[model samples]
Target: MNASLLLLIVALLSGLAFWAGRSRSLVVAGVGGVRTLNSLPFYYGSLTAFWCALPSLVVIFLWSIFDGVFIEKLVHPLIAPAVLEAAHGNMDLVMNQVRNLAASHVSAASVDPSVVAAAERLNSLENINRWAQAGVALSFAVIGAIWIWLRINPQLKARAKVEDIFRWLLFSCALLAILTTIGILLSVLFESLRFFQRVPVTEFLFGLEWSPQTAIRADQQGSSGSFGAVPLFAGTLLIAGIALLVAVPTGLMVAIYLTEYASPRMRSLIKPVLEVLAGIPTVVYGFFAALTVAPLIRDLGLSLGLDQWLAISSESALAAGLVMGVMIIPFVSSLSDDVINAVPQSLRDGALGLGSTHSEVVKLVVIPAALPGIVGSILLAAARAIGETMIVVMAAGLAANLTANPFDSVTTVTVQIVTLLVGDQEFESAKTLAAFALGLVLFMVTLGLNYFALYIVRKYREQYE
Candidate 1:
């Protein structure tokens, strides 16, 4: 019996015990003729149910985490020295392998009989777990029934007690989610700190280049792992710039059309169609950029008599950025449409009544009112453009040449991270660790943008609301 099944079994039994206790108490209190409760039998049932379920659920929760460690300790001491050494130091891996071997139907090459025996032992442990589950679930039900019976009285405050427990449970669940996010950020920060210790923090932050390739042995000691990150940062900024240039104005216009002018039927039709752009997998956009968009741009440039050496390739930053903009179009359009529509209709009407044209009212009153939300949406889209992986990976080149030309190819940080961690690279090396460092920087950048957006929204809200 796993923990979830045990929790559910306890909850069901608790509900039943609650019903029994409430029915008996109602009969004793003269609220019913040897029958139901006055405050609704279901409410009483629920109250008793919560009590029976809550305490045992807490116990099951605590037991789940500590039980495995305790069981492993006992099992290890019982094993022979040869078996223990053969299992290797990875207890979890050995346990998983044993379980798989026990369950598997196929016999492969290099199969050992000792492993087979260990697998058999695992089967025995499985049976033991089933028995323990049944025993514990029964114990919980019996104890809960007895406790509810003792607690029931004619004037008992069962409803309030149930509510208190439920409120605390919900609060604890919310806190758990927030704590998990903090835990993840802290872990990333610590790894980045380690990376910075080996390579100087100032060099990483302020250096003008980024190429993480270093020597392995003394024979090849002098290698350039130039931590200067200016070019990569500039490449990211340039790609994101091109993406926004395409995405913002087009998305805003679409939003205005949808919100201010479209009929109800047209809106229902158009909103879903716009969202379909969002739903298209990003990898598809990458393929389109590499195959279709890049060639079109290159041909257009040739027609204008541009240098062939400087023309866009299939993997140019412009191709990737344009595709990425198309991918995030729904984000800008949908968010802007909602915010525009949310502005009171009376405001638009007032402007029209004061001898203003429809376009004039939209440009002067509606847009100013909705500007904060629009800015927030644009910021989010820019951040998305910066962090995107698949579109850039399939379309942008791996070279980080610092140039302002939209036709030239450039690499993004995400593409670098993927290449660094690909195949069988050593994890302890600086090249791999640099990915974590880059992640930490990316986190900080996005966080700053989000906070700035919030500040603008708050200031605007203060003036308007």
Candidate 2:
């Protein structure tokens, strides 16, 4: 049977087991009623259902993991030794051909007779494996159901056992998340170490140039590639700084107005409309930046005669930063508004009772109370702006120039990472390995930002609390 069908059968059997366990508990109570039982009928039913499902699922999972390996080992002997020799030790290639031929109804005449025989044998083994897996899983499910059903009694302590099992499941999930994060960090760190071996750490960190085009052949000119990352870092900072300048004040003001001044109806209308920006896809924002905002900025610079004084490219940091700021405004305003609203009404009233104006009360009482969450929101928005890829790729041209001028085109670390890993690339090359180094640096920078934000939060949170 197929996995889906097997799962459906198992679910149905578990449901039946739940009913049987509940009935069995009631019978054992014997006219003293459910109050005589050590646990409730619900707990007895749940315990039976858990037993019926868990063991069967585990069996299916293990079978799926190892069945293919077993079958491949069995099929290996069917292929002729001559054919195996001709495969040049590429067992995976020979196996892929066997699987493809097995999947088709008519075997190709051009294929060797021994390979055809192996394909037929593979097909028979797969069918047998499926039947064996289904039999084992179903048998385990039945045995577990019968065992739990017979054991259900007044003194079983079913509730405690069920709760313990659930607690262990939650712990397993938490451990899985931690292990996954550690795995990612170790993978990136190892690859970055390999990259640093090829290019010095000092040059990667401190060098000013950012070209990463390594030549494939020794005789190629102008493609030896410079790996200085300072230009990319500078561009990233410049654009993110511009975005923060646009988003922070505007978002905070919008939040303050909605919470402290706007009518309920107006607040209801405006908040949802503002938050809709967050739902729009980033690629849509990219299109707006490239097609509309970039041109408008270029034309305005030309009309004002500013292009002569400054380098104004069609794709500039200002356009990307502005659009990104708009995109993240909802994140800031929504979070800040929630935080500001969480300030105690008693605090606001006490400030007003002391003869402070509404604005003074808000500034001294409400903002200080919400300062930690506000800082957290701004930090989140800054991270969002820094990590944005599509808008930067579309609006900010990939010129890796180390300049503070917003009108000049520039590139970011994310864009460079995308550029480096765009196609089929040899992992051993310095150009490809450079992407991992960039990722590790970016991860460190973000970690530092989180640490600083937490420090600010803790310092202010103590006084407010």
Candidate 3:
């Protein structure tokens, strides 16, 4: 049986076991009195389901892992020598042809009788394997159910055993996440080292020009792509700085107003409306930036009669930054609002009791008390702004201009990373490896921001508490 079918059968059996176990527990309790039972009826049901499924599931899992290899081994020797010679003695190639023929997905233009015979043998073996696995899995399930039913007495510690299994399952999930993160870092690190070998680490880090067009042919000029990443870094910071300039004050003020000054009805109505901005996709924000905000900014800049020097492109950093700032406002506002509200009422009362006004209570007591969380919220929004690609792509043109002017077009690291790895390209080339190097730098920047936010929070948290 296929995995899905097997799982469905096991699930149905487990469900049946649950009901049976619960009913059995009730019957036993009626005879011996409920006080004699060690655990509840629900615990008995859960434990029965666990017993019915766990061992069988493990066996099925192990069988599935080895089934492919076992089937290949069984079919390998059965293949005619002519078919093996046709595959140039390559087991993998022969196996691929065999599998394709078995699945009736042959890609070759010509057919061979030897391959056809081997495919028939392979199909027969697979059918037998499936039946064997199904039989063994069902037998394990039935045996486990019978064993657990016989053991389901008043003295059974069903709840504790079930809880122990759950505890291990949760730990395994956490371990999987940690392992995945480590794998990503190692992959990026190794690829980045390869990139650094081709292009000097100093040049990648500090060089100002940002062209990464490596030619495939040796005869092509500029094939040795300059991997200067300073422009990307500068563009990222410039746009992010502008976004923070707009977002932090506005979002913090919105949070302060909603939490401190606004009436309950106004807070209820306004907060949700503000947070709706977060649910809107970044692409929609990009459209709004490109069609509305960018054009408006350009016209405004031109209308000021300072056209001699004041130039604002339609896809300028200012447009992307402003829209991105608006997009990230919900992040800062939502987090800061929660943090501000978490400040104790006692602190506010104490501040006011010292002849301080309501404004003084908010500014001195509430804000300072919640400063760490507010900083954390701002940093989180800054990170969001840094990582945003669609907005920068649509609003800020992908020109890696290393300039400080917000009115100029610029690109970001994420935009270039997408550009580098979008199509089929040779992975060994410096052009492709450059993406990993960019990713590593981006990861480090984000990690540093998180660490800095933690340090600030820890340093100031106790002082206010």
Winner by TM-score: 2
Q: Compared with the true structure, what per-residue lDDT tens digits does model 3 show for residues 150-188?
A: 888888888898899899889988998999999999999
Residues 75-152 of candidate 2 have per-residue lDDT tens digits of 998888878889997788788889989999556586778889999999999999988999999999999999999999
For each candidate, the alpha-carbon lDDT, in order, equals 0.77, 0.92, 0.89
Write down the TM-score of every candidate. 0.83, 0.90, 0.87
Model 1 agreement with the true structure over 330-416: per-residue lDDT tens digits? 889989998898888888999999999999999998998998889878997998899898887777778876777777788877777
Best by lDDT: 2
Residue 173 in candidate 3, Cα distance off native in Å? 1.9
Candidate 3 TM-score to native: 0.87
> Model 3 scores what on Cα lDDT?
0.89
**What C-alpha lDDT, on a 0 to 100 scale, does residue 301 get in candidate 3?**
82
Q: After superposition, how far is residue 319 of candidate 2 from its true place, in Å?
A: 0.9
**What residue pairs are clashing in model 2?**
none
Runs of candidate 2 exceeding 4 Å displacement: 66-126, 216-222, 462-465
What does the lDDT read for residue 290 in candidate 3? Answer: 96
**Which model is ahead, 2 or 3, in terms of TM-score?**
2
